[model samples]
Target: MLAYIGKRLMQSVITLLVIITIVFLLLRLLPEEGYLGAAAEKMTPEQQEVYLTNLGLRDPILVQLGNFYSNLAQGDLGKSITYRTDVPVVEIIADKILYSLFFGLGAVVLALLIGVPLGILMAQMKGRWLDRLGTGYIVFVVAVPAMVYYLLIQVYVTDFFRLPMLFDEDRPISWILPLISLALGPIASYAMWMRRYMVDELNKDYIQLARAKGVRERTLMFRHVMRNAFIPMAQYLPATILFTITGSIYIESLYSIPGMGGLLVDAIQRQDNAVVQGLVLIFSSLGIIGLFLGDIVMSLVDPRIKLGRGESVR
Candidate 1:
């Protein structure tokens, strides 16, 4: 297990480095004006060249790459070049991450609480009205474009409930719409997958044998069916939770939530290369970490699964 973990960690590091290098090189291909901001308009070619040189933009690509890595090793993510000019990228992200974290956490909690039970109920009541109702909801959520529902919720729901249309930190009630919007997709996803897994478990021979042995339906459902069904789901839980906590870009932007998601969008629109680079690096790192943790979690949840080669148990 330790060896497997070590191997994964090394792979993650290599992947991250490759992603960062690719993004850095690509950003360099953008026009130099992104690095100078509005001030570039006033500067003569000579002055601009001088400015770019001072910023080390004129350095050889190899040298710049070396410098980037050196600074990265020391935790310096550089400064925002256009969006909130001169501010450290880390500082900008730190100021914005809390909002994303708060809403993201709320959304995940809401999704789990509602989605899991809905799935279980649907599974227990298969071929009944309740099952059909849950299935309909899942279908609607999955089929509809997210933006349409998000806008409807913002417009109609807010109007009906007399809630604020946009996010307002001072008005706690305003947080509701955005949180709900963020959770909708996840809720549908969890419900559909949970129901499918439970139903699959119910059809297996083990379940038939247990039923033949006179195990109570409820006991068999929860202890045997759900337990085994959840093993495969465990592999994705960490990744799902981690990604959810990173915030939804469309939801955050629609609600004007001032989160990491919106920040990335704003940086891209404004051509803030530094901020974009920093956010991309952070996001990529999180994705890698999430996958790494997911593997460990799956191994821990099911003893039959082994991380090391040639070590599977029947």
Candidate 2:
């Protein structure tokens, strides 16, 4: 297990390095001769060179990449170019991560709260009204893109109900609607997968044995069935978290929330290479961390499946 974990950690490091390299290369490839495309038209060549140099855009791409790696090795993420201050990149991300978390975490929790029970209900009530209702709900949500629902609720539906707008509220729970919309796809997916898994588990001889032994239906489902059946889905949580973060782009934009996803859009609009690169690195790191977390969690859940790096249980 220890060896497996060590191997996975090395792989994570390698993956992160590759991600940074790709993003650095992309920024270098952007068509700009030292901020030449900026909105400022009065800049002299020397001034432009200084500004770009300061942003490390003037260095050879390879040299700049090496420097970036060096700084990162020293735990220094470069400052924002557009923001034009000494604020640490990580600090900036930390400050705004809460909003994304508010939505992302809420969505995940909601999906689990709704999805797992639905799965169990569908399995136990297979071929009955309950199963049909569960299937219908999943199908309807899956058929409609989340963006459509977000708009529908924010526009026509909410207006009709005369409910306070999410963004208009003082509390972040006002974000609940958008968060639900963001989570809808994953919730739909979970229902489909978990229901099938639960059905399979229920059909197993072990389940029949338990039922024959007079176990309560609820205990049989939750204590034995759901726990074992949901293991595969547990492996999926990290990726789902990443998807939620990326999906936040549209949701945040629609809601006018000032989170990283919306900030990414602003960076692109301004051709702010540093902002774009910084965000890419930040999000990529988050993704890598999520992957690591998933692996560790899975290893913990099933010790037979040890980490790649052979590290002891975290």
Candidate 3:
């Protein structure tokens, strides 16, 4: 198991390195306009060369790349170019990430809590009214775009409930509506997938055997069916939890939340290469780590899932 984990860790590192290389090259290859912020554009050619030299942009490409990696190793993500001169990228993210993470995690956890039980109930009551209602909800949430629902919530739900539409750090309650809105689609997805997996489990030969052996219906559903059905769902838990840090651009924008989600967009529009590159690297690393953790979690959930072997242990 340790060997398998070590192998996966190596692969993840390689993958992250590749992603960094690609992003770095792409950012560098962009038009020089990317680096020419308002202050930079005003400089004479000599002053510009000095400025670029100070930024180490005057160095050879390989040298710059080496410096970037060296600085990154020392926990320096570089200074923001257009956003705020000399402000560390990490500092900017630290201030805004918590709100987005808190809201995002609230949404994800709430979705799982409600979606799983409802899905089980729906599957157990297949072809009944409850099943229809649950299925209808999944379809509705999936069919409608998130932005449409976000707008409707911002208008109708907030107005009717007299809740704050905008996020206010002083009042924690202000986060509720955005959390619900962000969770809508994920809730539906979890419900549909959980229902599908549970239903599939219900039809298995083992389930039939348990029934034939006079096992109680409740025990059969909860113990055997649920356990097996949940293995696949568990794989997503790590990714879902980790991705909360990335935030939702649409949700944050609608609620006027200052979060990391909108930072990338603003950076790109302003051609802040450092901020853009840093954000991309952060997001990509999180995604890669999430995938790695998911695989490990999946292996733990089912002993049959050998990490580096093909055949199951039985």
Q: Which candidate has the top score in TM-score?
A: 1
Stretches of candidate 1 off by over 4 Å are 311-314
Q: Report residue 208 deviation for candidate 2 (angstroms).
A: 3.2
- Give the clash count for each candidate: 0, 19, 0
Error of 2 at 225 (Å): 1.7
Candidate 3: clashing pairs of residues: none
lDDT of 2 at 45: 69
lDDT of 2 by residue, 207-307 (tens): 89988999998899889888887876777788788767766888888887778888788767656666677788778877887777777777667666645
True-vs-predicted CA distance for residue 54, candidate 3, Å: 2.3
User: Candidate 3 has what TM-score?
Assistant: 0.93
TM-score for all models, in order of appearance? 0.96, 0.86, 0.93
On residues 136-178, what C-alpha lDDT tens digit does candidate 3 reach at each position?
Answer: 9998898888788789999999989999989998988898898
lDDT of 1 by residue, 1-314 (tens): 88888988999999999999999999889888877778988999999999899889999999999999999899999998789978999999999988988988889889989988888888889999998988999999989999999999999999999999989889999999999999998888888888899999999998999899999998998898888878877777778877887758888899999999999999988888778888998888888888888888888888878887784621
The C-alpha lDDT values of all candidates are 0.88, 0.76, 0.84
| TM-score (C-alpha) between model 2 and the true structure | 0.86
Task: Identify the runs in model 3 with alpha carbons over 4 angstroms from their true place.
Answer: none
**Ranked by lDDT, top first:** 1, 3, 2
Q: Listing every candidate in turn, what is its Cα RMSD in Å to the true structure after a full C-alpha superposition?
A: 1.7, 3.4, 2.1
